[model samples]
Target chain A: MKLKIKDVEFKNPVLTASGTFGYGNELEDIIPVNELGGIVTKGISLKPRMGNPPPRLAETPCGLLNSIGLENIGLEKFVKEKWPEIKKIGPEIVVNIFGEKIEEYVEIAKTLEKEGIRCIELNLSCPNVEKGGLEFGRSERVVRNLVEKVRENFNGVIFVKLSPNFTDIVKISKAAEKGGADVLTLINTIMGMSIDAENMSFKIPRKVAGLSGPAIRPIALYIVYRVYQEVDIPIAGVGGINDIKSALEFHLAGSTLIQIGTALFIDPWIPFKIIKGIEEFLNKKNMEFKSIIGYLNKKRG
Target chain B: MRFLEEKSEIINLIDLGKDYYQIVISAPEISKLARPGQFVNIKVTGSLFPLLRRPFSIWSAKENYIEVLCKEVGIGTKILREKKFGKISLIGPLGKPFPEPSPEDIVVLLGGGTGIAPLSFYAERITENKKIFFAGFKHLPSPYLLRRLEEVCETLIIATEDGSMGFKGLLSELIEKEFKNIESEYTKYFVCGPYPMLKVFEKILPEQRTFVSLEGIMACGFGICMGCAVKKKGENRYLRTCTDGTLFSLKDIEI
Candidate 1:
C-alpha cells in the first residue's frame, strides 16, 4: 500500500492538500495527525499575506467556497517561528510555495530546499489572488518558463499544481513536464462566484472565490485522467477528495498520489480514515495498491 | 496527544427551562487545561449531519469535572442532551482566555441565555476581586446554573424580560443601576452574550478596560478557516477569535 515519490516514501498514498491542513499544528489537540501519510502546508510566500476581506468563506450544497487569498506569514516568520513546531509532528512535510514573480518563487523554493524540506509544491494556480498564480498557470509559455526557472534553482522534488479553470490542461501539464517538474497536483479550486440575488451583489466580500469540496471532484478527476495520459511525471490528485472511495477514484484515474482538501473543515479525521480504508479495500480484494494506477484509463471502453 | 477516551463521561444532565440543558462532563484533562473565557468544541455522539463540532465556552472547571451550559437550539445541542452518563467525544481548551483581573478591580460580569457559561468561570476565578453578576433569562433562572452562580459570585442580580423573576427589566438596565453609585475608576467589565447586549455594552462601558467575548458559528476552532474573524477597528486586517481571541479588549474590536 506504500507509494514513493522521489526519495520520500509514504505509508499510504493519502495526504492532506496545502491550505487545507493549516500546518498540522492546529489539529494536534483533537486528532493524532501522525497517522496520516503526510501533510502539505498552506502556501508560504516571500511576503506575509493578510488574505482577503471578511466573509472570505461560505458553505454551498455539498461544498465550500473560499477566498482566503493564501493568508500566511512570510518565509522568514514561517521558518523561524512556525517551522520548529511543524517539524515536531514528524510527518513527511511538503512545503507549498507561491509568489507574485518568477524570482520570488525561485527564492522561496531555494530557501525551503536548503532548509531540508523534501518537496516544493509550486502553487501556479491559486484562484483567490489578484495576480501571479492564475496568470502564470493559464499560459503554457509562462508555466514552462516558471517551472524551468524554479527547477534550475531548486534540486528538491518539484511539483507544479495546476488550475482547473483552463480549457487546455494537457498543454500545461506537458509544459511542466518539459521543464523538469517531478510531480503534478491537478486542479486547484475552480474559479466560481455566488451572488446574493436579493441585494444584487456578490455573496462573498471578495466578488470572486474558489469553489472546492465534493462539487469539484468530477472535474478534478477528469483533469487528472487527462493529464496522466500526456505527462510521464507522477500525478498528485487533489480536489474535493473527502474519503477513501474518493481517493481511490483518483488512483484509478492515474494519480500516483492524492491530496485531501475542503473535507478537512468537515472532518479532520477523514484523511486518516481514508488511509486505513484503502488498505482494507486492497486486502479484501486481494490486489496490490499500485496495480490500480491508471486502471480506469485502460478499462474505458 | 493522549486521547483519553474514558475521561469524557457525562456525569449529570439537567433540563433547564426554555429548551436549555446543563451538561456536566468528567473531563479532567480539559478541565485542568481550561482557563476562564476559553471554550471547547464538542462532537455529539452518533450524528451524521452537522458533523462539525460545536464550540461552547467552559462554564466551570474543577479538579475532576467540567461543565457546559448548552441551549438546545440546533441539531448538535439537541443530540448532546440525549446522551447518557457514559458517552461523548470532545476537543478543547481551543481558544484564548480572558486576561486575569486586578485584585482591587471591581469585576462586573454580564451574560444572557447560554452565554453565561464562560462568565461563570470568570466569576469563579476572581475570588479576590469584588464581583457583580447580572444574569438575564426569558423567565426564571435555570435552577442548576443559578445555584452554581451563587456559590461563586459576591453579588448576583437577576433580570427577566417578562417580569417572571427578580427585576422587571433588561439585564443591561440592572448593570447600569448597580454601577450608578460607584465611581467608574475601579470597574472592569467582562461580557459574553447575545450580540445586541455586547454591542450595547461596548458603547456604554469605558473602552480601555471592558472585554467582550464574540460568538460566531465556527467550523474549524482555529485560525485556518477564517470563519470566526472580527475586523479590527480602523485596521485593514481582521483578527481570528479562535487564535487572537474569543476575549478581546473592547477598544481593539469594532463591535
Candidate 2:
C-alpha cells in the first residue's frame, strides 16, 4: 500500500493533520510514529507567536472550536531546538509553515529547504491569524503569488492548504496549480465561533476559531470532489477524518492522501487503526491504491 | 509515567448536593500509578456530540478504586451526572505529580469546593508531615468528604460563604484568622480552586512554598493541542497545563 504525491512516495496514505500532531514527539510513547505514512508538525512561523488568550478550545455538538493562533517556536528555534527531534521520527515529516506576510512565508520555506525537508505545507488557511491566514487565501491572485514565490525559492514538494471559507474552492485550487504547487491539502477548518449565552461573552478570547471533527466531513468531501474535478494535482484530504470509513470517502472522492485532525484528541491510536483497516479493505477487495482513488468520479454515470 | 486508557465502570455515583457528585470507579491499574496532582480525562459518552474529553483531578484512590469530584456545570458534566454505572474511557495518570514534602515541614491544604478533591488525596499519602485542611464550600459539604478529610488531617477547618457552616466568611479570611494561632515553621501550602482563591494564596504565602493545581479547558489532556496554556511569571511564553503541569509552584506561573 504505497501512495505517491509529487514524485515523493509515502509508505501509506494516512497522516496526522498539522496542529493536531504537536511536534510528532509527544505521541511517540503511545504509538510508534514510524508506522504511519507521515506526520505534519504544528504550524511554524518566521517569528515565534505567543498565540491567543486563555480558553482557546471549546466543544460543540460533534465538533471542536480552537483559536490556538499558530503558536510555534519560530524558524530559528525550531531548526535549532525542535527540528533535530522531529527528523528522528520514522514517518515522512511535513513542516506546516505560516506567515503574517508573503515574504515571511517564503522565508520560512527557504529556511526549511536548507534543512533538507522533503515537503512543506504552506498554511494559507489558518482562521486564527489576522493577516495571512484565511484572508490571503480567499483571493485567487494572492494565493497564486504566495505559492509562486515559495515555488521559486524551494525545490522540494510544496502543498497549499486551502480554507473552506472561500467562495469558489475550485478557483483557488486552479490558482495553486498554476502557481506550481505540487499538491493541495483540500480543506482547512471552517471558520466559526461560540458564546456562553448566560455570561454573554465569547467562548474564545479571539472571538472566532476554526471548527473541526465529524461535523465538517461532508463539507470537506464535497470540496475535495469539486477540486478533484477541476485540477490534476494530488489532493491531501484533511478535516473531520476520524476512521477508515471517513478516509475511504476521501479516496473515492479523489484524494490520494488523508490527514486525521480533531479525532486524534479522542484517540491518538486512530491513525494506526485506520491504516490497518484500509489494508484489510484493500486486501478484501483485491484492489490497489490507483484503482480505488477517484473510482466514484471516474464511474460517474 | 504509567498511564492507562481503561473503560472504567462506575461503582458509585453519589450526589453530594448542589449539583456536585462523587464518582468512584474500579480501576486498579490507574489507582496504582496515581499520585497527588495527576488528573484523568474521561470520555462522557461513546457518541461524538461532546467531542472532547473532560479532565478531572484524581480526588482519591484507595485499594482498587479511584474517585473524581465533579460539579454539573457544563453539558458534559450534566450528561455525566445522569448516567449511573455506565462504563466510559479514562486516561491517566497524566501530568506531573505534586513535589514530595519533607517530614519536618507542615503541609497546609486549602481547598474551595471541588478543588478539595486532590488535596484530600495528597493528605492521605502523607504520614510524616503535619496536615491542616481548610475547606470552603458554598454550603456545608457532604458528610462523607468532611469525615474523610477529618480522618486524614490533624486539624480540619471549615468555612462557608452563606454563614451555614463553621467560619462565616471567605476562605481567604478564614486563613487570615487561623494564621495567628499556628506557628510558622517549615510550612508549605497546596491551594486549588477558582482563580481568585489562588490569587489570594499567591499574595499571602511565599511563592516557592505555594503549589497550585490549575483548571483549564483542554482538548487533549496530554500535550498535543497546546490549548490549556497558562502565562509564565515575568515571561512572554506560556506553559501547557496538561504536560507542563496541572500543579505548578506559584513562583513559576501567573495565577
Candidate 3:
C-alpha cells in the first residue's frame, strides 16, 4: 500500500491526476484527503490563468475532450492565498507547474521550494495550452532541458508528466530519467477530436483536445509497460484509471503509482473505493504489492 | 455547503411535446441541497458511451424530489427521453444560487424555451417581492408549468415567435419594452435562455441589477475541469460557471 520515489513515500499507490482534483480542497468534505497516496493540483503557472473560453469540454463516445488551458491561481496567489487552505487538508500535495517559457518553470519551482513544498509535478504535457506544453513533452531535448533547470533549484521530488502524443514514448521517458527526474508520470491525455457531422463543425472550440476516461486505458497501459522496460526511474501511470481492475493493470504493466483523472469528475470518492478494492484484491491473491509490479513481464513461461 | 452525489430513481418522465420533456427524480439529499438558480449534473445512460453528465437547471424541488425541464437536442438528451423509470446518477445541487431580492424590489424573471426551468424555481422561493415571469417559446409547447409559475409570480406573460399563443417577436424586444414602462425604484432581473437572448438582454438591462444563469458543456460539476469558463467583462480573467456561478452578476460577465 506504500510507494517510494526518490525520498518521499506515498501512503498508497492511488493518486489524483493534476487538473482533475482541483487544489485538493473541493472534495475534502466527501473524500478523506489524508487517506490517499497523494493529490496533484490542477496545473499552475507563474501568473494567474483564465483558461480557455466557454465550451471548453465536449463529451465523446466513451471519452471526454477538454481544452481547459490549465486555469489556475498563479504561483504568488497560490502560496499567499490558497496554500494555507490546501495545507489544512493534510495530503501530500504535489503542486503541478506549467510554463510558457523554460524560465517560468524554474521560477515556479524556486517559488515552490521557498514555500516548503515537498513535491512538484512538472506539467510538460498539457494539450490545452497554446504555448510550450505538449511541444516540450514530446521532444527529448526539451524535456531534458526543462527538467534539468527545475532540478537545479528545487530539491523536492520532481515528477515529469509526459505526453502520449509522442511517436516513441520510451525515448521521452529516458530523456526525463537522463535529466534527473525523481519519478515520471505517463501518460497525459491523448490528443483527439470529434466533429458534429450535421453542422460540419468541431465539437470543442480548440479543434483538438486531450481525450481521457475509459477510452484511453489500453493506450496508457501499453506505454507504461514499454517505458518500464526502458527507464530506471519510478513510473506514475495515469489516464483512464477508474477502478481497482484498471489500477491493477497499471501495476502489472510496471507502474509503481497510479493517478485517476477524468474518473474523479464522475465520482470524487472513487479513490477510497479503488484503495479498498485493491486491498481486497491483494488479500484474495495472497500477494504483496511488489508481486504485482512488473508481474506481467516476469519469467512466467 | 457541499454538493451530494445521489442515486436517484425516476419518479416521473412526462413528454411536454415538441421535443420538450419534464423529468422528475426522487433524490432526498439533493432536494435539500438544491436552491434556485443552481443545477444538477445527470448521467443520461448508465453506460460508457456517453462519458459526461448533462447539466440541467433545477425546475422544482419539493420535500424529497427534484425536477428538470429537458429538450431532446442531441444524442445524450435523446437517450434521456426514452427512459421511463429507473435509477440514475446525479451530482448536485451545484453552483451558487440567485441573489435574494429585497421586499421592496420588483424582480423580473425572463426565460426562453427550456430556460424557464430555473426561473420557475426562483419564483417559488421569493414571497416578499413583486415577481414577474416572462416566458417565450418557439411554438406552443404541449404542457409546461405555466400555471404553476403563475401561482408563484405576481404577473406572467407568454411570448411566442410564431405568434401561436402570445405576442409575436423576440422575447428580448418584449423585455426591452417592458423594462422601459415599469421603471421601478428597485428592480432586479434574472434571465436565462439561448446565448443570443442573453446577449440581447446584456445590452438592454442595467448591468448592476441583473443576474444571468449561464450554461456551457461541462465535465465536472465542481471547479476541477474549468470547462465552464465565462469571460469576465472588462477583465482578463475568466470565472468558472460551475464554481463562481451558473448565476453571475451581469456587471461582472461579458454576456
Query: Of the candidates shown, which would achieve the greatest DockQ relative to the real structure?
Result: 2
Q: For model 1 chain A, give the 10-residue run with minimal summed lDDT.
A: A126-135
Tens digits of per-residue lDDT for model 3, B1-255: 489889889899998878898998999999998999889998877877688788899998999999999989988788888887887899999988887887889988899988998999999998888888899989875644666667788798888899887788889988877777665668888889999999899988888888899887778888777787889889988888888888888999887
Which candidate leads the pack in lDDT?
Answer: 2
lDDT of each: 0.80, 0.87, 0.86
| iRMSD, per candidate, in listed order | 3.8, 1.2, 1.3
Which lDDT tens digits does candidate 2 get at residues A99-216? 8788888899899999988899998874325443447788889889989999999998898998878568889889999999998997889989999999999999888899989998
Error of 1 at A97 (Å): 2.1
Question: Of models 1 and 3, which has the larger DockQ?
Answer: 3
TM-score of each: 0.82, 0.96, 0.95
Give per-residue CA lDDT, model 3, range A1-301, as digits (tens): 8877667888998899998988888777766889989999988899898777767887877888898878887988999988888877876889999887888889999988998898999988743244523477868887898899999999999999987785588898889899989888998988899888998998887888899999998998999998888887788999888778999999999888899999888878889999999899999999998889878854222
Off by over 4 Å in 2: A126-134, A299-301, B182-185
Which 10 consecutive positions of candidate 3 chain B have the poorest summed lDDT?
B140-149
lDDT by residue for model 1 (A2-77), tens: 7777788777787789888886687786677777777889999999887876677665655677888788888999
lDDT of 2 by residue, B61-132 (tens): 888999999999888899889987898888888898888899888999999988988899899888898889
Reference-based lDDT, residue B191, model 2: 89
Total clashing residue pairs per candidate?
0, 0, 0
